[model samples]
Target: MVIEGWGVNENIEMVDRVAHCANKLQGWGKRKRVKFKEDI
Candidate 1:
């Protein structure tokens, strides 16, 4: 389910926003991995 706008500028903005979310997800995954290792 992707919600995109109609326009070049809007598309760029959406991409940037999505990229930011992706970065956060990557960071969160790394943190979780470290915690899992510590638990083991």
Candidate 2:
């Protein structure tokens, strides 16, 4: 379930747009969200 291909199958237009936007704003670290690990 990575954000490369499977995450953007096509039907999820909003997701694709957001991910693409994040890629561009990565330098600024503007991308929001906190990913947690099961082990943690």
Candidate 3:
């Protein structure tokens, strides 16, 4: 998941995309009763 050697804008976009996906998964887990414990 590391945005290695990427430009500033690209790095931000990558982070935003990951956050968005994580949020979606979090919501899905809530509905399905799946536990998503933080790994770090």
TM-score leader: 1
Per-candidate TM-scores read 0.69, 0.36, 0.53
Residue-level lDDT of model 3, residues 1-40, one tens digit each, is: 1233333355368677677667766667686664444432
Better of 1 and 2 by TM-score: 1
Positional deviation of 27 in candidate 3, in angstroms?
0.2
Output the lDDT of residue 34, model 3: 42
**Top-lDDT structure, candidate number:** 1
lDDT of 1 by residue, 2-39 (tens): 23222334546767768766776777789999999999
- Encode model 2's per-residue lDDT on 1-40: one tens digit a residue: 1355334555667777677656656633432323233334
**Over 4 Å off in model 3, which ranges?**
1-12, 34-40
| Alpha-carbon lDDT, every model | 0.64, 0.52, 0.56
Measured on C-alpha atoms, candidate 1 has an lDDT of 0.64
Better of 2 and 3 by TM-score: 3
For every candidate, C-alpha RMSD to the true structure in Å: 6.4, 8.3, 8.5
In model 3, where is the ten-residue run with the lowest total lDDT? 1-10
